[model samples]
Target chain A: MISTHLPALQIILPLLAAPLCVILRNGTLTYWFAVVVAWLAFAVSALLLQEVNAIGVIAYKLGGWAPPWGIEYRIDLLNAYVLLIVSAIGALTVSYAKPSVDQEIGGDRGYLFYTAFLLCLAGLLGVTITGDAFNIFVFLEISSLSSYALIAMGRDRRALIASYRYLVFGTIGATFFLIGVGLLYQMTGTLNIADLGERVAAVGPNRTITVAFGFMAVGLAVKAALFPVHAWLPNAYAYAPSVATIFLAATATKVSIYVLIRTYFTIFHHDFSFGVMALGDIFMVFAVLAMLAGSAIAIFQTDIKRMLAYSSVAQIGYMVLGVSMATVLGLTGGMLHLFNHALIKGALFMAMGCVFYRTGSVSIESMRGLAARMPWTMAAFVAGGMSLIGVPLTVGFVSKWYLLLAAMEQNLWWILVFLIIASLMAIIYVWRVVEAAYFMPSSAGAPTDIQEAPMAMLVPMWVMVLANFYFGIDTKLSVGVATRAAKFLLGDAS
Target chain B: MEWPGLYNYWIAIFLMVTGLYLVMAPQNLVKKIVGLNVFQASVFVLYITMGKVTGGTAPIIAEGIEVYSNPLPHVLILTAIVVGVATTAVGLALVVRINESFGTIEEDEIRELEEAQEDAS
Candidate 1:
């Protein structure tokens, strides 16, 4: 019975703790509360994953109300995998947020910071676990609102502007999504995702359905930071507090991608979405553009955080490219990249946070001779950077391999070429930082006496860095789960 | 084409396009927020329009109510309105902060200041 409630508890525990954090009013106490709640949520997610694996789909009706009438918390392999990724990143980032928060965001606002963080975490989990169409929009707003606050909490004055820009774009995205959902509800007269899927199939493709799909796809693309609509991401990530960057970079867009996958594969049949609509072809075009343009822009950014933010856009393209392929191997690659990129980017951003903790700057020029001073931090950065480059023996390599395999299976040689070229671009951008940190001599005014980041920060960073290699070499867990989830998504779609 | 039956949707579409245009075309941050509000309000109307039935009364228990309008979209809109209000509040708060720091709420002015700062540094 307790295991049955894991779906609800995963969200409730964090949601309740958010208000408690604000009530506590002490910075350190609130942080500890967040850490405990984050770890508890992670544990609950792990339990849910195990339960889903042991049995099958675990559906828990909210308030004991039956389906098509009340909201449901549905945990299939796909949901469980995403839940695991989100909470795992949440736990790791919260553990590392303490010193980083104190350094970057000093003041009595720390309690509020933790409160917003917990709310965002809860919202993300809610979005992942809920089986209702309307619930996704509600949770999406919850997370978006809290994240605006979190981004604004940064000490930089520009943070306010970045947060505002994100708010404007994010609101438009959510509104578009609502219109799509409203159209769907008008057609089907249901809000439950499973029931909607059945009804949508029965109704087939109509003008309303086509228009709804367009709105939802475009809306989710904005949230996921797809090419041409990703203007808000770099500034928001570059200027947000370090901890916020780490968490958002790791999980936010990944969850949006999950929403996209759920909408296309679960709610709309594959034939209607891909065959009739040709959305896969359109997605492929955008994915290619994103990979090239994002990397090209990143190569020009001087600030390390901004560079990583642009790289995130490129990395998202890789994942979307996999989904667009619409093959078993392709979906598997996308799913694996979803998990692997979280690890890769989470560790990379955490390393940047540690560097910022000691040096107070994240510009590439400021990191001259960082390898000599903050060896551990720079080392972790190197490891994470290698993973970003998709080097052999790293998780990134595994994802790209599957993606390449998928492309090859379709005999899409052009896509295969683009994947390789994008990886080279990743190497170039990541190498810029590597060269600055390792090879270049320290600037004349650079601090020679700077110390390595605190053990607390280094520990979590290394854990993720190590995971980049560990999961790379031992592909059993991530690859197996991803392949199974992909198969589940592709089932009955044709 | 039946003008009355399709007119509601046309109005919703017009409002949606106007709101979107304001959001895209405006340079003032506050004006953009207003645009966002109008955009969201259009969605509220759209949802409510879908919930309407010809000659239907309110979905309240009565002795002789044969056709009642669906209430779910109304409930969903209520939640959405709350989210919209919260977003507006947060957006305005951010604008206030931007004004305090940068001394102007104009997007062009702020961008100029940032570019100048970048050039100087």
Candidate 2:
């Protein structure tokens, strides 16, 4: 009986714990409370994934009401994989957050921080698990709003402007998404994703659907921080409190990419989305530009956190490029990268968070010759940096390998050239930190008395770094789930 | 294709375009928030207008009522309105904080201040 409602509990557990954090009031208590809640959410997602693997699709009618009329929490291999990623990151980020949050945000506002973190977690999980199109909009706003609050809580005054800019852009993206949902509902009487999928196919190649598609694509593009529309990301990530940056970098935009995949592959038939609309060609162009331009921009950023944020945009391009291929292999690469990049980027950001914790700055100048003092933290950064560069025996290489095979399948040699150049750019950016931290003498302004970040921080950061290699070497779980999910999206279901 | 019948859509499009322009072109942070509100309000109008059934009364179960407009879009829009209000609250709160910190609400002024701070650092 408890097993039947796991889908709903997966979201409700975090949503309810959010207010309880405020009630708890004490910073340490709220920290432990959030940690427990996050882990419980992770356990619930694990069970949900197990159940999904056992049973093909788990569609729990929310409130016992039928799907077309009432909301439904639906989980397939695709979203179950995403749910696990979000919750796992939530758990790790929450555990790592106590030290960082206390140092940066102060204990006075700790409860508020945890509250927003839980809300953002629940929102991302809801966005991934829901089958109702309109439900996605509601949860997307919940996440985005909470995240804006989270970003604004940063000590830097620039965080305020970053959060505000994010607010304006994120609101526009969500409203555009609402308009798209409204148009879909106008055309089709039902708002259930499956029902809309069927009805939209029946409506067949109409102007309204095309317009809705455009609106949704653009809206999600903003959410995912896809190129050109990604102006809000670098500052937001750089200025937001370390905990918020770690969590949002790992999960928020990845969930948006998942939504993009769902819209492109599952809700609308592939033929209509790609063949008639020719969105594949359009996305391909933008994806290539994002890869090149985002990476190129990352090379110029002096702030480590902002550089990773720009790197995220470039990595998003990789996922989009894979999806634009519209083949099972391509989508598998995209999905795998979605999971692997989360691990890789999560570790990198956490390392920077540690740097921020110790030296009170994340600027490259501060990192000069700091590897000797913060050996574990800098080592984790090096491991994560290698993964980011797609070095062999790391998670990044696994996903890039799949992306390469997918590109080759389509005989797209030019895409291969782009991928190699982007990878080289990743090396350049990562090496800048390596050279400063390992080779250059400590700058006079650099703090002489800084020690390693606390064990609480280093442990979680190392867990992520190790997992990057574990998953990379043992590709069975990540690759297996991604392949199944990819096939499911392409309607192969094998 | 009946131009006269689609006046509601025309209004929604106009508001959307105008609201978007306000959001993008405004140098003042508060104006951008206002622009965001107008932009969201346009989407609300689009949703609410689409829900209206011509020659239909309010959605209600009554003995004499024959045709009722769709209630779903209205319900959806009601939720969207709440979201929009929350967004406005957050946006305005952020603007207040921005003003307090930078002592100016103009976007360009804040940028200048930030750049100066960066340069000094």
Candidate 3:
């Protein structure tokens, strides 16, 4: 039955709707259509997640051709959860984009904005659901291409330069990923991920495969904004319009982090993950570095958006560090962090959009006394930021709790110390912004009397913020699912 | 050992590296777009080369030789190429806007202006 392969349709519907959004040629209609299609994709992803939870794994072959020979869309517990996160956030973000897009982009270019948004969402989903190694690269380009367009659509002239810089970096990342695939394909003569895994196991100690792993690790490291290689992220996120920043900041790099986990742990096996270079140590080192450096850099930023961008780099470090432990608990922590951070940051970024909507500027100094002016918006920021700081009752805390436990399990006491220190750094930066908003003197003389943003924005913002808190308490949807996915990703290796 | 044996992959590698270098080092925006094209073209060649049979011809349905290059990579690359072109066009379009707004086509100069603006504020 065609219905059984709902995982494929979760990606396919939006993939089909992207071009339709373009051809429809009306910004408002295209906007609504994209939102609908995105939600429809979310619905399909939820269904698929349920099926995966009940059953084992779902692999749907393209055009009735079996895998390793034809394209395959594989959904296990891991990807099914990712599919749900990506599609749900994408749908809500698209609805939020409608009014924000209309306010930012002029009438003529609005249609293009929605079109590119849909394409990017579709591409992210495609990358999430695909089982083939090379298809990952293909879908990566789909998302990257649309992302470049979306970034460039910013009204600010600096956006073009920012988009170009991002293009250069993004292209490099993709090239590196491709070379990795090519090298692997050369050794194994296969492009299917599962088949490549099998053949790679046979080849065992081939230098080519090791080199391929290096290429992919670095490529994904850059894409995920692991510090030092994260130069393109701050400006791209800061300069792009709020909608683009929110959508990408929430989902894109997080997805790359997922790919890194999948390729390293699932596809390559734990032996490869721990062998040769003692990769676990290397990852812990870099992840800690990212954590410290990102927080320190964000502390000094005057621009609120750029600060969040740097914060994302730091958060990515936690996820990578979690994965670096190379155990079930570690994998669970990292995977859970990925989901938790997405929710918290997604909510935070949406809150920033509200601030931008009211103030039309993202300069932190410009937002003095904004807490009094737009209390709801500022409150959302505080909520998300508390979650970001991993307070006792937030999703961020749950992620951190798991990570701390994982570190303890590994008996890496220094890592535990580093995590605590890094979180203190997070508190410093977050408190800076909160102090400015609530405590700093009103810079605009009378606080500028800026009203709250429209319901179109606030409702979505609250939903994400509330979800962060709600999921923090429940943990069943996020933790239960991520725990299952973690077992799946590490099960075979373990 | 012949013209298309291992030589094809070597060519693919060469093109791929060249494209990557171009994008990395270029100062002008349009050159970067061209670089992205070459990079994607190289990927295309890799996929196409991988699809070849020992003595195969095109993948048409009526191939009497019973040897046809795999069509999957070609199809996938076609979609990828289209995506590549879309990205390039958008990059160039952004460059055009950059030209209009900043009145400069060079990355260095635009960066100078931004730094100056940041300092001025």
Cα TM-score of candidate 1:
0.99
lDDT, candidate 3, A1-494, per-residue tens: 86776867877788888888778888888888888888899899988888888887898998789888888888888888888889888988988887788888866678888888888998899888999988899889889988998988876777778888888788778878887887788678788887887788888867888888888988888888888798999989988989999999989998898888778876687777777647788888899999989988999999898999999989999999998888888888998998888888889889888888778888878778888888899999999999999998899999999999999987889989889988998898889889988999878444466898899999988999999989889988888888877877766433
Q: In candidate 3, residue A78 scores what lDDT?
A: 87
Q: What is the DockQ (computed on Cα atoms) for candidate 2?
A: 0.91
lDDT of 2 at A207: 88
- Residue by residue across A1-494, what tens digits does model 1's lDDT show? 68768888999999999999988999999988999999999999999888888898999999999999999988899989999999999999999999999878884778899999999999999999999989999999999999999999887888899999999999998888888999999999998998989999999889999999999999999999999899999999999999999999999999999999999998888778888998999999999999999999999999899999999999999999999887789999998999999999999999999999998889987889999889999999999999999999999999999999999999999999999899999999999999998999999998889998999999999999999999999999899888888888889332
Q: Which docking category, incorrect, acceptable, medium or high, applies to candidate 3?
A: medium
Evaluate residue B19 in candidate 3 and report its C-alpha lDDT on the 0 to 100 scale.
89
Q: Which runs of model 3 end up more than 4 angstroms from their true locations?
A: A444-447, A492-494, B1-14, B42-80
lDDT of each: 0.93, 0.93, 0.85
Fnat, 2 decimals, each candidate: 0.92, 0.90, 0.67
Q: Model 2, B37-118: lDDT tens per residue?
A: 8899899899889988888999879998898999989998889999999999999999999999999999999999999987
- The number of the candidate with the highest DockQ is 1
What is candidate 2's CAPRI-style docking category based on DockQ? high
